[model samples]
Target: MRYLSLDNQRDGFILAARVLMMVLFVLFGWQKLAGFAGTVGYMASVGAPLPTLSAIIAVVVELGFGFLIAIGFFTRPVAIIFAVYTVATALIGHRYWALTGMDQYMAMINFYKNVSIAGGLLLLAVTGPGRYSVDGK
Candidate 1:
């Protein structure tokens, strides 16, 4: 019988989740920066009051939080920030129930998925980054 210590398991979880978050953040953030016009247009389509400003903010938040998560520096704060940001995205961008005159059902499902992921991120924030993190040192 072999057993992984509590600390080891927690660190493994943190590492996996952190890497996933890093990839997600970097990709989305880079999209916003690389395709500024497209991002602005998408924001406008989604009824963003200030599409340009929203794009900028999204880029910064995703990139900044992504870096923070990757390094495990202030992991809790970064995770919380990401959780809140994802929630807002789910609400505003994928307000599925609010969609009308088309296939609205699918939108709601996606929104819920985003919400679930946000919940996971919130959990990570509450749990901290465990023994493998910079804060654990």
Candidate 2:
């Protein structure tokens, strides 16, 4: 596609990117909301500090901020927040170095996945949410 044509599609592309990135958070957040006790228990089992608080934060960040991102509202700052949150989750929840065998392998995979998600969010921070967003409006 030509530069101008592609430029016209910029908003569409950004919308796709923004929504796609938020999917994981939104879905997981919903799951957490549906199973609050289980979520807290899982967090405690993972040795997360203040399991209840962490679970609450997870639901807010994932569902709340994730919704904002989906609608392109406060996209830039929210994306940065998501990026940082993603990295923190990786460090706090996926400590592969403290595990062994298959558990270690899964943690390693999850850690990298969170890191990769953070990277995408960082890019979204720079790119903004394009013309289809409230911020863009």
Candidate 3:
């Protein structure tokens, strides 16, 4: 019974993580495609040199990696990519907001949040999707 409970817990965790990944990625991917102009503008605002390239990357990463995450296919690779992307975005975009001083405290908080998320992604990459995943089969 104890083993069964442990299995159940791990399965629950994987499912929750997968679902969260799916929802966030799908929404982000849709937004990138549907609001290309908005995405381009956001990229420009963040000082991204190639807004078009940024948009393509966002869409591909969100949709492609997101699907792999949801289905538990190539989970580690996808998670690694997401982890790197999160860290890079935080450093490139949010770091500037923090440099602007105390008025942009929210930027610092968000930067930390992104780092935390990257940590979680790294953990998932290492631990995998548990027994609930298709790959686990």
User: Evaluated with lDDT, which candidate comes out highest?
Assistant: 2
19-68 per-residue lDDT for model 2 (tens digits): 88888899999999999999999999988989999999999999999999
Model 2 lowest lDDT segment of ten: 1-10
Stretches off by above 4 angstroms in model 2 are: 1-5
How far is each candidate from the true structure, as Cα RMSD in Å?
2.9, 2.1, 3.1
Candidate 3 achieves a global lDDT of 0.81
lDDT of 1 by residue, 25-107 (tens): 78889888899999999999988769999888889878877777777889888888888888888787887777775557777
Report lDDT (CA) for all predictions: 0.81, 0.93, 0.81
State, as a TM-score between 0 and 1, how close model 2 is to the true structure: 0.93
lDDT of model 3 at position 55: 79
With a 3 Å backbone cut-off (N, CA, C), the pairs that clash in candidate 3 are: none
The number of clashing residue pairs in each candidate reads 0, 0, 0
Can you give the TM-score per candidate against the true fold? Answer: 0.84, 0.93, 0.83
